[model samples]
Target: MYPEPMSKSLEGKLVVAISSRALFDFEEENKVFEDSDDRAYMDLQLSRLDVPAKPGVAYPLVKKLLAFNTETDNRVAVVILSRNDPVSGLRVFRSAQEANLQLERGVFTRGRNPYPYLTSLGANLFLSAKEEDVRAALNAGFAAARVYPDSAVAADRHPDEIRIAFDGDAVLFSDEAERIYAARGLEAFQAHEIERAAIPLPPGPFKPLLEALKPLQAQPAGAPMRVRTALVTARSAPAHERAIRTLMAWNIQVDEAMFLGGLEKADFLREFEPDFFFDDQTGYCDTAARVGPTGHVVSGVKNEVGGPRPSDR
Candidate 1:
């Protein structure tokens, strides 16, 4: 067996914090009635706890964090939970402990306060706090939006990390949908989506990025690898052809990919876990951030464009 690494201070890498709900992908049985008190908090973070998750499902998230941590020596999966919710908090911490997850001390909620726990620990917490936090971060030129209310405070914890994730298609790829929308309009875009459902769409804008990281992939972890990447797109099976092709063309490999069809992406994201998940749509990012961290990829389409070509992004 490989010797377990000692838990040392996470000094230089990015931390992708996740909640138990996302870490375990709680089963349907864990579902709580929407009427519960925990389901109606002002910050919206507490309300997400009603969703149930199992610790066993946290393997991937743990493994990725371990790999990232081992390679770059800067990765940590700080499991953040509210001390007010002791049962869930204990469950999350124990699960990580059993897996020997390289966790930066567990967080026990600071209420409306932003204590910057991850910052003090030298790892970033990829989340935001309150709407003001989002607005202020964005206003201050930090990539901010109403990511996930529950984990919004995540940003408050770690502000230095790039903390980015991606959804396939329009986000990382060109605005083909917007292109189709311009050429044939909304009906055409929808038609293209349906037609391309099996044909697979082309790569998104970030394809070049993945290609750039290819060399890094060859460099083993702990040797100073920057950026943690994943694919949290809603496409699956036959529809996933284009995403795979794009990566192949660009020669970029992602750290992870979850094909969830139309199921709540947040459910799977809770497990793969990310600092921020970028998607063209708001709902996916909204739900995903609840479990981990999420972001919206702004479209940079030119208005007079004659539609997106394969080489566009």
Candidate 2:
């Protein structure tokens, strides 16, 4: 017998579920809530309902991404999966309206874990400010990242290009090498890469998301905006060969690749000026955030988290 068809409403679309804090600057109100309580926060947001919040780190990325939906048959869907109570979510919608963002759906968890809903949403990627939520999302098999509020906001570097960067080990690939590095030291890590250069490292949390992006990357040549991915890793020289070979093994292509070894990535990211950058280490995110939007992958040995969990991919 033949199988059932897919849901037309969501068939062949890239769905991204992001949080309010990740999409808009809720730092001030977040401070209020943290210093005080939820009641005070809700009151503040309701009082300032007419006031629009400023764009946060992922704002530009979202705006550019939504631009791809101009076609009658939409190719993308973005949902606001925020932890804010439904009441406070008003401000989020108001801000999205102020920015002329065409967002239409959301789920306000009211301080509860929002990761479970990602499965029902069929989310290809989830972005949030809460590390717990991101971790939960990843554990549940969805691609998730913790947005750094302190990181640089998205810039109008190139209106027609969607530039995204990714870190190597512990991010695009499994933390196996990271495990060796942490157990021993940098010397051991380099040695492992050299020895296993021909062996492709296991896939990491973002591999599913990267695979999903391939078809989107193949969009028409002159589409208003196109995705240009880059591999910005800390591995340099002999270590770089393995990474290149690994991508070749996976049959994936990155527009540009940078192997910075041990150098600080902020300056390099500043030059690349990606709309968004994902790294497993907060250090890179903190520094790179100053240049452009950034997200922290809360996975692998460095994250003090467990190995890849079985999930949706």
Clashes of each: 23, 1
**Model 1 lDDT per residue over 138-206, tens place:** 233223233332443232222222334677766556656556655565456556666665443555544
Candidate 1 RMSD computed on C-alpha atoms after optimal superposition onto the true structure = 12.2
| 1-313 per-residue lDDT for model 2 (tens digits) | 8899864465477889999999999999999999999999999999999999998878898998898887475778889998899999999999999999999999998999998988888898999999999989988878789998887664677999889999998889988887777777778878989998999888888888788788769988988889999999988888888889888999899999999877888888888889999998877777787888889998887777564332110
Candidate RMSDs in Å, in order, are 12.2, 5.1
TM-scores, all models, native as reference: 0.42, 0.92
lDDT winner among the candidates?
2
Return the top candidate by TM-score: 2
